[model samples]
Target: MNKSQLVFVPCPGMGHLIPTIEFAKLLINHDHRFSVTVLIINSPFDATYNAYVHSLVSSPSPSFPTRLHLTLLPSTLPTNISQHHKGTFLDAFFENHKPHFREAVSNLESGPDSPPLAGFVVDMFCSPVFDVADEFGVPAFAFFPSGAAYLGFLSQFYTLMERRGVDTTAFNFKDSGMEFAFPSFLNAIPAKVFPLLVLEKGWESFSRNHARLHKKARGIIVNTFEELESHAVLSFSSNGGIPVYPVGPILSIEGPSNPAQQGFDVIKWLDDQPPSSVLFLCFGSLGYFDQVESGFLDRTAEVGIVIGWAPQAQILAHGAIGGFVSHCGWNTILESIYFGVPVATWPLTSEQQINAFHLVRELKIGVEISLDYRTGFSNGSKTEVLGAERIEKGMRDVMAAKENEIRRKVKDLSEKSRRALAEDGSSYINLGRFIDDIMNMK
Candidate 1:
């Protein structure tokens, strides 16, 4: 009857934290001999995340609340740490949580209901915590919530730079024409589409540290399915580095859409739209639109309701939604694929550029808004405004054909994704194998 409890340290960003929770829920739901405790690294920049965790802890008909525990780490940002900090400040932000995690693990060991500590599943950004995991004398995993391709970039970029003697210092973002033979992609990857932060002035060291940690973990768990990224998924096996577990399309909580609940009006609005007509353009919660200068009151809102936040999965699932104007976040990419909605790929940051490339060039399931249009906190790309023409073209191309090649592929993958998560499917079997790895850790 002994159960091994796994502690997951997910990064504070909603894009990262939400999926980690879903993965934790899956573990406890799929098997009875395992339990999960998700250590929340709260973000001072966003209270929405705070509300999210509260909802998980306080859900009325909880999914796996008995065996799943979500609690805040004691390292909530202090007065000295400014709310508007970035760059190395984030490094300090994650580093400061180490002792808090150590203390939380200590407290868990003493708790009456606590199971034997299995190990730690550290998010890609929370690599500093691998040190604490090392101290605890248990294995640690690097949870890459994005996908196999992004994981491939992090796993190999250090070698790409060092072994080739490529200079990180002199790298220029202006060389949009250059391409690299990155291992993950089917086609040669354009240099311009690589993550902006990794090439920035101060982030090289940070990127290297992350690359180093990816090697240190016993394995990397990706929120992807083998059917979706077979090339990138298979690349890990040949390299003979850290093992990878593609136990995903590990999606967010999906309950029946209710008219009375949050995001009801948006859903109700969509109820009137014709099938394969509406295009959902959501940039995730971290993104924003002030919408001040334009004459707001006179607009009919052709592109569905413009809300602060959305039940994205529900909207995408609706027959009304045909194409998604996406930031190409991995979660949204999988969701778009799951719902059979094609994407107008517009990458904002992180490895989204590579994701956009994957969608447009490799899978042909998306059209590009601006493949190399990198942006940051202040929208620091060469052209920030993204002209109306380019945006229109992206939307038009994706929505151009109802039963086109992109649509067909998306539908096929959607069906395959559903099966992959079902009993005895690829992702399902992968999840079992990952769990077996944990149980064997004992």
Candidate 2:
């Protein structure tokens, strides 16, 4: 069989880029007929983004020996563009790159020796590029780095508006007391806990545009296992005309982007502690941050390490990790599940509150710290400090669980997650199906 090329366009964020690369590796390693080239959007703001890419480009992992190629799209957006306003930045970046991206793909395909361009697999954030895919008469699949549940939750707002005939231009999310029984979530999620993007005023149009772009895509590729979010996965089949592929728990099991973040000191420290003793408080790349109070240093001398970037997977895998006080990012949630550490959820932004809701309420794999905290506000305003009691309670609930069942469930799921990557596993089978779908094209 002839080899095929798939272009992966992941936004410059570390969380999204890392998993996309891993998925690329999985595809090429599992089936020799596919080769991937990840096209990176220029993000000068994130200092670590390029550093991480450089690490992967320099040294590939052994376990999954992917000849995954990297190409950085030039900085086409003008320097005069305001980085402060996210909406302006997103629109500018998305629109500016269409012609540049088209030209780049044209160059890749110009050589007669190049493999047939099978499809464009893009990050959820880059949905606008489906237009580019259409230009080439190639299918584009939006790769949502988050889980199915979050995607389902996002679509619910739009679905509700469509069903109710609510005008997107006129509608305002002023009803704080509102609640909806989103299909993915087992219980009705409150308006207060909805992602700020869906609720905030100026963002309504952006959200609408994003959903519109998504409709143009051939399908969606979610980063979750069928065994984990079976309900949300099944829901997509009945609802949208588009297909949904849940092939994941896709992780970089090897190491981080920076070689300096290697786990020597942190591992040594973890080795010193007893089994199930440490409560980890690391967040994802942006540091949707949390910190211990100075007064409590004497009281709790230990959640103590202040390293720049610890080996998160290694730390989660350690015997000393009792539980995680997490920001509830999708990747973080999966890692916690894979490592069998129950989460004490402290959601900061994006779909994190929703994730925290699903984990604590729907899935029952974790407990909540502050589900609605700091999730509803952006633009560097609204920084409500959590009371010491809430922090203490969260730490207490995860480590010393009132519901021992949460711990037991997480432990069981960890084994299942590992198996999902194996040949006979659900994700493995879905991954094969994903490849077949690409080959069939559509």
Candidate 3:
């Protein structure tokens, strides 16, 4: 009676690693028959990342049924790879790590006393591992850490580009607002809200390779609940080639609270604020507050609590947090929604632009700072610097009583998000279905 083993390969970033780890915990908790081995690609720049992954295993919780094991592979790229490609290092890094990844999987499979190999679960960035999974006669699942709408857009964009023969990189949106039809959306997606990958250089080849690899996967998993993105989830699930499962808002109920911050000064500051009176602004890992113009900071400080960094999940869950000024990363969007905090959408890079659109337009849970704002991707496009006035106005709009309806809507959705992860909810059922599908794989 050996337990089944599922190998997970997550891209070398906190954003990808967090959700993938949570998903693994979900699988093991849902049923005791599965164990997860996460293969993490060593980060040359961040020496602490591997240590963080190891901590998850070392610090086991009594609540979870099983512990996750982690293995750190050697750095696949030279130390100076970032100096070469600059912003496009992720695209090149994943492509270069194929050999290292394949060898690691082979070694794991050949080890004596190994549990029966159930399948391979890979981050969307590591889709190249599909071939390795096929070699071992196991199913490979693509885990998308973002919303279903972004996944739907990725799946449909390449086909649309081919059909229209439009070079997205060459298209200019100086004065006119260009719109394109997507099956996932009832209305057309404006050029301003298109993913930054389409606008960035050197991403065309990477995106094409990603799309091809995704199509080869046996199934796709997204970090969104069906109630949140019904249309987009249906679009991905109906593809017929690869089955798609919506099994998320897969956040840790315990939350990622920093132990050191228990009695910290920031906690005192938050305690002093009135309930639902503060606004929390957090971008993802690479995000920085210093990149913002000085004038914008001066004005925002007058309106809200401006801290360098806080425990985001804890802050969002706080009674003092009324609104969020976010870069609209999918994780942040989900967290804010979970806490019933409306957002002032200011998308920075990657699929955030599309997520911003969904937050503001579709979900009606967020207000927009600017749809045309682009930064952090190094796409040769001039970075849009928002002035103090615009920033203040956006903040005012999000926190004002006029936005009470939006707040009420998000509060309702937050309850639904929680229920979706409960025993008989949509996400819970989908996760069980996915696990059963893996067990049935022959």
Candidate 4:
């Protein structure tokens, strides 16, 4: 039997690429009959990502049964696209790159000695390329690198726009305390914490197109486990025309080593702290702390350790790190959860605010810092500085002796997360089922 090969196309960002790669490793680890070829769309802003992808391909994981392959596809977005109309640039960028992506897939399919192309697994941002998968008669799956709740919300929002002709962007400007109910959440979601995409120009139409493509996918795979977002996963699976698989918390156990870790005195300092005593603050690559608010670090240095950058996975897994003050990027959240670290949520942009809300309110594994922090496309005002009081309060809440319930819940969830990747576990079984579905496609 010819080995089945799956093609993964991840969006240009490190967050997207890392999980897609980890998912590929998961697939190859669970079943020896498969191999993966990752097609990375190189980003001009992050040139180092290309080298990182190359390294992963060249140095296959020692644990996985098969090695994953990689191909770097040139980004088609113009350099000037970011200078103007930045809100819709991602939608525009992916649209422009579709033809090139299509050509690349075509060439791969026609090559001699190529494994049978089982299917295409594309990042959520690369939904437009489902057409490319169609051209070659292979199934395409949408890999959402976020939570199932966000997926459920998107599906629900799309339906509202179609049926009621509602303008979701208008919700952003509504009364400050207004909340809207979605099928996925038990409580109403505040407009402030809703996805930033709804407020972007041309977002309604872009989202409509995305929603249509989502339904057209062979299946939608989310990076969450059934235990974590049971209701949201069920809601998404029941309503979407396509099958939705909660097959994740798929994370790299050993992340790429941060070269900046060498001279950073923070790691040495962390070694001196008592176990579970320090709060670690990490905003992702695109996120940053305001200069004015940087003084909060000086004030709280004794209680916390702030680093500009560190090996996040390793840091989260550290014994001295008790709490995470995060931007609530899905990857960062998962890593924190996997390491049994509770969070103090400080959402910055994108779906992060929603993720933060879920972590603090829904799951009760994290404490809230400020849901009102203004950032992202919708906020054109001056950069909102996080007050020291709010920061200090969040730190206290996460580290409080009375908050052991939060700690206990996160620790239990961390074990579940580990088990979900084990043999016959939820994520393990779902991944196997996903692989079988692909193999049957051939």
Candidate 5:
């Protein structure tokens, strides 16, 4: 085995951090020689969150191998960026930190306890790490913690820019919508149905980072199975020859047994609900749904419980979870399918909307909200939200007897999801391959 190690740099937020942590754990368990260290970036972690993570890393239990380690870097958002600002604060945060990040990487490379810095596995959004990897003479791979279908959408960004031009003035291309259709895994979404980052005013900061990172990365890794998105995943690879690894259905990677051992009481409550009777709703940490949105969900309390953040894997593994009202992030999608729960999607930002489209259009295991992405506010600033009636209705349709067929189909998909991480399943095989590749790297 190669003496070099695997280093993961995950951006802040549970959506990004959880998957990377799981991946690191998987690598270490498979081969002790392959050490895994997770780098936490820019976190103002409170006692509760930090303690939870520390417990996982320090647990002397059999669940985690001793080789897994975590390093917390000094993290602080730029001076002007705080939690409350919604509008342009995101852009401002990125603008302020890009330069400081370069120096941080330089310092870490030379810092004590740094391994040979074999390679970097970074969140798709943390593109700046690609530059740092380049500076340190190591290959960096952007890990899209979403589906293969969504990664295919991003792989086409450069082509879309050239064919349609940068202005997005042609956004109203109803006439040529079919010409730019997304992958079959994405369902019925037109190429037009993406987030504001694709259509925002000018070389927006997010868009710039995405493009630069795509150009810099040695490869791209998506969290999905080939059987689910083979055509699109292949097309993405064929287009740029950008070696795509569809190593996913990650919820199944650790085993059919749930990895979330901490939340036992929550699992018991979930089991009390009837089959397909509950709806799991979560929007990661970065997502902040306002009181209006919260109230809408609260109104549906008679039908299902809506906790701020339920133990996702445990709940999905429960018998009562019939459907999901998810933000369509990658981890939720994979977990829901792993447990065979159908989805009702209302994706907000990042790769979510694209994921939502595929869940409804291609997979037939979910429902998508009829949101007007083309006309919505660019900054996600909005006073109004989907009403309780819509939420309740969508939930009912998914849980109804009339939709038994939907449940059956999703059940079948879940079987496939499980198989994907089974002994020879796609995800299982890919994970083994990844371990071997990284371990053998010279």
Candidate 6:
């Protein structure tokens, strides 16, 4: 008869927020006795943040039963000592917000118990949650809000940094060469384009701080399916002294759309090209492309429809989309597989490089572009800047009918994804297990 409160604490970014919301919604729908709360990060993003939150709770759910709530913290900005804020004005933001956040959690710990605070599911970047959980003497779990392969890369970032040495660490973007070897598929990318988060210098302190915080958590919750990342998730569980739950394809929380899904008109936009003829492109909520990157979009337009932000679940459900030109983010990957769409990986940052690498080299479903390590190569020749032609060609190769072979290979994966979230699928089982595990934890 004990009611449990599952609080979802996400990172500051949209990519993290959306999927975590979906997970929270799923948890809420799973059982009537279980209630969910989305703990706001308390940053500038709070403005439009609540809208996304409202959309979920406002919708009707026929699956399980429960209600979703929101808990907003004042807001945590970057700090002067924070890696991303340093040299910028907001570096010390976290420093100021830490005490306020500490107070908030303490208050929650001491609050009334209609649905008592049973546990916390925190984002990987929310460092304050770890200490707050310890302060309250409550178990807190880390949510990566990304795929499993990316987790593997992050868990080993220290090793990658140590092996590369201080010289590479000190190198700036302008001077950086192909000195660092990235793990996963990103390892082959030039040292420059690996996303600012992976850069060792000037950012080392932030990375170290996050790694330490992650290790101290009770467990890690990943938004993925076991069929897709069983090995990597297992690796995390074994090493982290915490179990890593791969409960994802949570987008299915939208439930069955059935016949209307077939009539979902957008499929006509992709008809008659070829099987796997389309390359779906979406950057999630915050993935923006500047004029320099515009050519990549233009070139891909030649072979496929270029969408600014796709209703991914709807697009993936379509029969026309054969491949996805994705950021290799966890949610995208999970959704793609759920709909059986193979991927064309382009990792922007964080665990993307590793996710991209695993997709291309390990999963054999996609391909990635050169990461511009400043080796000065143009289509394998010496060049000043990255020309659009090569990117165009890469898109052509990825979207070609012959490459339909890759699509054929991914068909089973997609079906598995579909089956995973289905009634008896692995994702469904894991979700039930997750609630049971947390509720029963001592």
Tell me each candidate's RMSD, in Å, in order. 2.7, 2.9, 3.1, 2.9, 5.1, 6.1
Candidate 1 ranges with C-alpha deviation above 4 Å: 58-61, 76-85, 169-171, 174-176, 253-264, 292-304, 378-383
User: Can you write out model 4's per-residue Cα lDDT over 1-442, one digit (the tens) per residue?
Assistant: 5677888989888899989988987788777777888887767566667667666666756764445777777668756764645545666777788778777777767879777788999988776788788888999999999988888788777665547555556744523565778888877888778776765655655665665656678888889998888888777667646777778898877777656657776667878989888778788877764563668867986666556667888788889887888989999999999999999998877788888888888888999897656475544353668888999999898888834899999999999998988888998888878877877877
Error of 3 at 218 (Å): 0.5
Question: How many pairs of residues collide in each model?
Answer: 0, 0, 0, 0, 5, 14
Model 4 misplaced stretches (Cα beyond 4 Å): 47-66, 78-84, 161-165, 171-176, 265-267, 290-306, 378-383
Q: Rank the models by lDDT, top first.
A: 1, 2, 4, 3, 5, 6
Error of 1 at 348 (Å): 1.3
The clash number for model 4 is 0
Residues 347-385 of candidate 3: C-alpha lDDT, one tens digit per residue: 777788888888888777888886657674553345457
For model 5, how does the per-residue alpha-carbon lDDT over 180-283 read when each residue is reduced to its tens digit?
55542434456555655665544355665665555777677777888777777777766666666777765533322224544546677776777767767766
lDDT for each candidate structure: 0.80, 0.79, 0.77, 0.78, 0.64, 0.63
- Displacement of residue 131 (Cα, Å) in model 5 is 2.2
Task: Give each model a TM-score.
Answer: 0.92, 0.91, 0.89, 0.90, 0.79, 0.77
lDDT of 3: 0.77
TM-score: the better of candidates 2 and 5 = 2
Model 5 scores worst on lDDT over the 10 consecutive residues at 252-261
